[model samples]
Target: MATGPAKDEKCCLVAVTLDKDTIGQGPPDVEHERRVAIYDLLEKNRFVLRDYADEGPYNLRLQIIDRKLVLAVDRQDGVPLITHILSLTPLRRIVRDYFLICESYYAAIRTAMPSQIEAIDVGRRGLHDEGSHLLIERLKGKIEVDFETARRLFTLISVLLWKGQGR
Candidate 1:
């Protein structure tokens, strides 16, 4: 059995990269969200790949290739680990719904009544939670991530899926 990180040791992302071509096509808001998510994820996150012996601080490069989400992971020293590919098909509907609710929430914050804004915000959070849960489920065997980490990753994924469409 492979030994994982120590209980008190936190496995964090040392570097993160997104596909310039695809992410560049996203709007300003997508860029903003991606920046925030990357910052938050690197600041603190729990990520472990089971059955692997390498130690990390890891580096991750994310991209959408042929309708699949590809994660090219490496050790801090640039040693390659595994390139994990997950289908974006399962996440399409949830990402679309989350983006729609987010748009509503942002618009409501600008002009809607206080109660309406709160309601929209609540819905937005709910969808966000759902997306996070779905991500965790999908990554079950390949990688292990804490809920907070998954939530932040979900934000990044959502941002990548701009225009309410899969990347």
Candidate 2:
């Protein structure tokens, strides 16, 4: 499998890997085009994705403030892709490890379903204080960013991911 890093400034992790057995694949450009297609879509939608260069079959977890956005694709069908939102209610430390397992599963499934090309937000639930609740509500209907304030919010929320992880 070929793994490479993404060049986006805001992304901290981005990678594309294929089954090792599938050597001399269809065309190198297939992966490239697929990557570009996904990246372009996220960029067009204003969602910032991090890029990381590592081995195959890893989970993509994006921490936005007090929320851990975890993406998981099915192992065979690649359909019914799941995105888990772990509310950093108190934030924990075990998130990184759990996130890895999540990625591994996604990577394995990605091999079987080459035709799967859809993403669905399974569900979202969280714990929050009054202020956080207000902010979360505001962030619900639509996505908006206030740069300076959002930067702080993201930092705070990201920290919350590890708060209750028995660290």
Tens-digit lDDT string for candidate 1 (1-167) = 01123244436666778777656566666667777888778777888776453566677777788878888888766788899999998888888888888778777878999999999988888888888999999999888888999998898777766733743
Q: Looking at model 1, which ten-residue stretch has the lowest summed lDDT?
A: 1-10
> Tens digit of lDDT per residue, candidate 2, span 1-167?
12334334332223323222221232333334334533433332222212211221232333333343333322221223344454543333333443333334455446644333122111111221233444444455333333332333333332333333322
lDDT (C-alpha) at residue 88 in model 1: 94
Q: How many steric clashes between backbone atoms does each model show? A: 0, 25
TM-score of 1: 0.87
All models, RMSD in angstroms: 5.0, 16.5
- Lowest lDDT 10-residue stretch of candidate 2: 117-126
Instruction: Estimate every model's Cα lDDT from 0 to 1.
Output: 0.77, 0.33
Query: What's the lDDT for residue 7 in model 2?
Result: 36
